[model samples]
Target chain A: MNLLFAAEEAEEGGSGLVSPVIGVMLWTLIVFGITLIVLWKVAFPRIAEALDKRQRMIEESIDTAEKTKREADELLREYRERLSDARGQADDIVARARRTADAHEQESQAEARTKREEMMDQTRRDIEAETRRAIQQIRSEVADLTVLATEKVTRKSLDSSDQKRLVDEALAELDFAALANEERR
Target chain B: MSQSRKILLGAGGAYLLLVVLAFILFGSAGRQDFVPQEEFELPTWIELGPLDINKAVLYLLISGILTCVTMVYIAKRMEAKPNRIQTAVEVLYGVMRDNITRGNMNDKMAAKWFPFIGALFLFIWFNNLIGFIPLPTGHHHFTVLGLEIPTFGIYAATANVSVPLVLSLLVFFSYTFEGIRAKGVGGYLKSLIPAGVTGAMAGFIFVLELLSNIMRIVSLSVRLFANMLAGHLIILFMAGGLAILLGIAGIGVFLLPIGIALYLFEVGLVATLQAFIFATLSAIYIGGAVAESH
Candidate 1:
């Protein structure tokens, strides 16, 4: 039985192996054709589209980022300009205030000087008028004294020339005494 | 035109020449026995001992060398700009690049694996086409302890169950390694279990996953082995049928026309399809192995 099995195995092995090549070939052709068609038509197109969409999305994102950066730069430039303008305005205000203070100081100083001068002039005029009035009062008092003295010395009524001379000499002596007293005080 | 189309044409032409040569050589010699000659007597080159040397290994090595040299020569002579041969190679590269590697893996992963897949496809393709050529048909004769023993013709490396099994095992291990490396070992194991399952269901799923994981090796091996073996078998039967028909006394001459036509058609289709099947399965396996979790 074992010998028979061995003989059968030897005879059958190579022959059985050689007969199915044609059928396998036909089957392969059909399957491969079907696979290729399906892949080319449906699957491959979808995969390619997905890849293209991904590429577009990435490009768009990069573009948006670049645009944002540009906008930020523009805003920064505007802010810098505004800051510089503010600094310029602040300097101008300080300068204007300084000039106005100088003008006010000058005006105040001029008004004060003018008021001092007017007060001095009024004091000088009052002193001059008072001096003139004092001098007149002294003269009248001296005249009255002189007239009393003359009348006592002569015991009678005198002529106009004698009265005049006595009055003049007395007045002269009173003027000299007044001048010396004024000098001592 | 496309490189693939050009390669199809070239390969097709080469195949035609090979078929014509086989018919002229074998048909003129007259009908012989159904069993290949090597089965009865061994070729003198092989030897056996405590460590037996495989007769098929020498043939595979020769086939590999021929394939590599031919492909490299074609690649080198390719035009700087696109020509027929260059276009064919380019299309082959493109198919591997765009479809197999990139389709299966992320770009980073695909870059590393693309070369291996390319080499694999070319090797299998050349081997399958070479089978139709009129090489020495029979077993090898080698000395074993000063004794000679016969072995079968270089079992078209892809046709043997063992060879395809090993290829599949290599793929199986490599992908499993990739999964483990990509995700940690724990995570890799976890990935095998479907999400949203609970308790007993999860346990059941894990068992199923384990079984399937083991079955992956079997499936990969069987798919390749069956395809190549089946194609080879069909070609043999067709040829054998002609041989048997011609061996008959009188009516054999009339059947020659039908036999010749069928032989031409069968050989052509078988050669092309075997290569295609090998490449297609490799693509599918790699695709399945590396697909991202849903």
Candidate 2:
């Protein structure tokens, strides 16, 4: 405690280090009080208000940005959905057109086959009729040639009953049915 | 060519210049005092009733005026997109409001006390920062061209015990009043003890707590006062005080660089740090007073 005593003595001996000066203290209080009051009344409130306003502005901006982003996202989703629907409709239309085309092709092919068969039938019937006429002409020519040869061999004109008899014999000997069969083959 | 070599050469050159200057100024002078305690003594420049206008009061007035004007001006001109000075002011405001005041107390209490705490921080910080700057407030004077001019020296009003003492006293009373206001006198005293302690042990603890409470003023004041005073003294001694005292001014050549470094350190960190600590402690005291437990 001797040290404390020495320090106290030093303090008493006009040491400005620890000694309290009333005027300075009073002045400190006065100055500090005035500063506090001035700052409180004028400076601090404005600063606080500005800070609050800035904060609110920032929050509002953030909210607006978020809302816009959400709307854009929604629009994008809707557009994608519509595009997908359009694509699906296009696919269905193509599929239906393909089906119609397939049906039309089948019908046209069947009609062509039927027309071709009827034309082939008509062509075959025409050939058969022409062959029959030609065969009849050949038979009549054979009969007439046979009659003329008989007259020439006999060296005299035969009577009607004789010619008839000769012609009947010649016709009986001829195979007209076989000739027509050969023409058909 | 190497970085270290370059730095060494630069230091050597500076040291040589300082030695030459020191020798030219004080080579023939005898021993001188490093600690001139009288420098702390303020002489009245003006007297009005009980008030003696002096350098300490002058510094306080300047600090107060600057605090008020700078804040009010910045507050008036604030914008959403801040410029450089506005950004700096905003950063300081955030530090005072968020770190010091609101860090320790509830929002209500913080709002109520933010102005006092902010002013305290600004006032103390300005005083501490200006203390490192050499001003024509020295007790000594030199006559140049038949006119007396005060010498330029560094002094801080915070280094004066009375200034911090008064501020600390205010803090002490404010917190004490808050405690009593929050709880009745008896309840506030009872709350000083820890929650579990009872009987005589609780009484002993309460007395100890009360004493600790009282010591806040000394701790708060002395902490600020001693730090500032010590920083200034170190700068003074290292700059030339020791060389002057030892009758070898040439040694200041080596000490001046260290003095410069310490000067930067004090101005850069200690000034702001001390103010922050003072305001933070004030907040904590006030916050603790209103809290349910000690």
Each prediction's RMSD over C-alphas, in Å, is 19.1, 3.3
Per-residue lDDT of A84-169 in model 1, one digit per residue for the tens?
Answer: 99999999999999999999999999999999999989987787666667776767776666676667776765677876777777
Mind giving the per-residue lDDT tens digits that candidate 2 earns over B1-294?
Answer: 999999999989987887888788877677754345556777778997668888889888888888788889999999998899988888889989998999999999998989889988988998898888898888778999998999888988999998999999999999999999999999999899999999989879988998999999999999999999889888987887777767777787778889999999999999999999999999999999999878
Model 2 alpha-carbon miss at residue B30, Å? 1.7
Please give the C-alpha DockQ score of model 2.
Answer: 0.55
On the 0 to 100 scale, the lDDT of residue B167 in model 2 is 95
For model 2, what is the alpha-carbon lDDT of residue B234?
A: 86
User: Candidate 2 regions off by >4 Å?
Assistant: A1-10, A154-185, B13-28, B33-35
lDDT (Cα, tens digit) per residue for candidate 1, span B1-294: 999999999987876666566566555565554443223221224444322224234434555566556555554454434567656656665676677667766787676665555555555566556654545445445667986754323245456554455455656776788777877788777777877877988888988998988887777667666766555544444444345535542233334445466546635765455555555565555555555561
What is the Å distance of residue B208 in model 2 from its true position? 0.4
TM-score of chain A of each: 0.61, 0.79
Q: How many Å off is the CA of B158 in candidate 2?
A: 0.7
